[model samples]
Target: MRELTIDWTALHSAFQMNMPEVRCFLSVEDGKVQKLPPGDPNLATVRADPQHFIPIDAIPSRIQYQWLDDFIKALEDSVVRERMEAAINGKGAFRRFKDILLTLPDERRRWFEYRDQKMRERIVEWVREQAIVPLNEAPWSADLPEGSPPYVSAHIDEDSLGNLA
Candidate 1:
């Protein structure tokens, strides 16, 4: 496995973005994330050379929803938890959840931290699956507990629904 120092924030942004007309890639040689819009000349070249450019798959909405569900479950306040549970049932769950969080500053901060930790774990797993070791220190470098559940879901193409989280 090759080791590369990556820009963690850029990589995280790339992972979070999902658009039909745009594609993201990470340079295996340099670990820089590139967002290629439709019709870009480099798109074909990058697609042709998998060894040098690895496509960055967006984190699926189901995984993100699961994170929200998990966070809601951990909340101690029944009223807030009930509201969040109600918010996640249908199509606009992500936006609705954010709206609720916006009113609660402390809980919103906690949610961001929780989400970031989950995202970091997912990123680490992804790089390892690609046979690449991240050389830079991750925000959460501690070993995940044994038998941690994997967050795998089929891709949900719903760009019209807006951001997943």
Candidate 2:
């Protein structure tokens, strides 16, 4: 089975929440509240396709309004709370993410951004390094023959030879 792991360092700058913990935000619309999912689009967009980048005007009106309401209300109540709530409502996922990202302590946020950027740079460097290795390199240890210089040195005692025989 493949185990799933998360790089929560990105999340702290992105989510404004404790690392490696599940955080939920409630979405409010027309004064009614509902639970939002952890990976809701309003908060995080892991994979971006052209379709996902649809602007607020391009997105269905109902989704846009509900998201704005939830995000705005949460912002009014508490910045942290607002982020969490916006994350849930499936509205303003990117903008809400950007807003929460802006609310972070300047130094800490800058550090996080730097760290994330560095990680990407390092990953690219690593991939480039790996690409240069020859694919056909021998994968096994040397297999020495009997009486070869290496084999003779490896077995100084007659008993070792007898054992192998």
Q: Which of the numbered candidates is closest to the native, going by highest TM-score?
A: 1
Please report the candidate that would top lDDT against the real structure: 1
For residues 30-53, what per-residue lDDT tens digits would candidate 1 score against the true structure? 889989999999999999999999
Question: Model 1 — which ten-residue stretch has the worst lDDT?
Answer: 152-161
Show how many residue pairs clash in every candidate, following the order shown. Answer: 0, 3
- Residue-wise C-alpha lDDT for candidate 2, range 1-165, written one tens digit per residue: 111122222312223333333432211111111223456664453223222221111223454445434434423337565555655456456565555666666423443443333333332233233232212211110222454432111212222222221
Candidate RMSDs in Å, in order, are 8.2, 24.9
Error of 1 at 34 (Å): 1.7
- In model 2, residue pairs whose N, Cα or C atoms come closer than 3 Å (at least 3 residues apart or on different chains), thus clashing, are 25-84, 36-88, 42-93
Q: Each model's C-alpha lDDT?
A: 0.78, 0.33
